[model samples]
Target: MSSDKKVRQATATVTELILETFRLNGRLIEAGDELVRPLELTSARWQVLGAMDRSAVPLPVASIARNMGLSRQAVQRLAKELEKGGLVRFAKNPHHERARLVTMTEKGRAAFAAAMAKQAPWAEALAEGLSPDLLSEALAVLRALRVKLEGHDG
Candidate 1:
């Protein structure tokens, strides 16, 4: 086959995979929402908490949004709600006067921990037949796609 034909076939396969990924993302969010319900957390709130929990120090809302592939305004709104619920707090950013940093509170940490506990079993069940190697390979592919998407965002 010609190189052009091969490229077209690869593009079509990737397009189908991307569409399926979107469907899977929606389902995963729904499942995550259920998993964090015990902590009175929605998937959106849990996402913000998880981001902060993973960070060693506080992060600006824009940083969090970029890390999570979300809009800065959306993250700011969620941060406000999280703060009102005592799950997170904002502190002055020494580097930036206007952009305060967001940090998870003790309550947020507890909720995140609870959610993680629930996640362990859920993930294990979902990975029952999937090989670790296969998952890692899939992750690499997805990461490459994410990088490509971000590159085009500008």
Candidate 2:
């Protein structure tokens, strides 16, 4: 076979894999929605909370959006809703006058902990047959793709 033929085959396989990843993302989001339902949280809210929970210090809406691969406007909307729910509070940002830092309240932390507890079992069950090394490799590949995509606008 020709080298050009091999390149085209590889490109086709990568395209198929990307599409499969999107399908899996939809399923994962659905499962996530179910997992956090008991905590009165949707997958979007849970993700925002999770990001704040992971951060050592408070972050602005833009930072949260960047971390979550979401738009700043979308994160701002979630932050506003979370704030109204008393799950998060905004603080003055020393660096920026208008951009406030978002912090999870104790209530938010408790909810996140509860959701994490439930996620532990679900994740373990899902990983029942998967190899740790394989999972790590897959994560690395996905991260690499995300980095490349982030650098491209279209």
Task: Using TM-score, give the best candidate's number.
Answer: 1
> Scored by CA lDDT, what does every candidate get?
0.92, 0.93
After superposition on all C-alphas, the RMSD of every candidate to the true structure, in Å, is 1.9, 2.3
Model 1 earns a TM-score of: 0.95
Clash count for each candidate, listed in order shown: 0, 0
Instruction: For candidate 2, list the clashing residue pairs, or say none.
Output: none
Worst 10-residue lDDT window for candidate 2 reads: 145-154
Q: Write the per-residue lDDT of candidate 1 for residues 14-95, one digit (tens) a residue.
A: 9999999999999999999888887899999999888888788789999999889899999999999999999989999999
Native-referenced Cα lDDT, model 2: 0.93
Summed over model 2, clashes come to 0
lDDT tens digits by residue: candidate 2, 1-154: 8999999998898899899999998999999999999889988999999999888989999999999999999999999999998999999999999999999999999988999999999999999999999999999888878988899534
Candidate 1: segments with Cα more than 4 A from true spot: 152-154
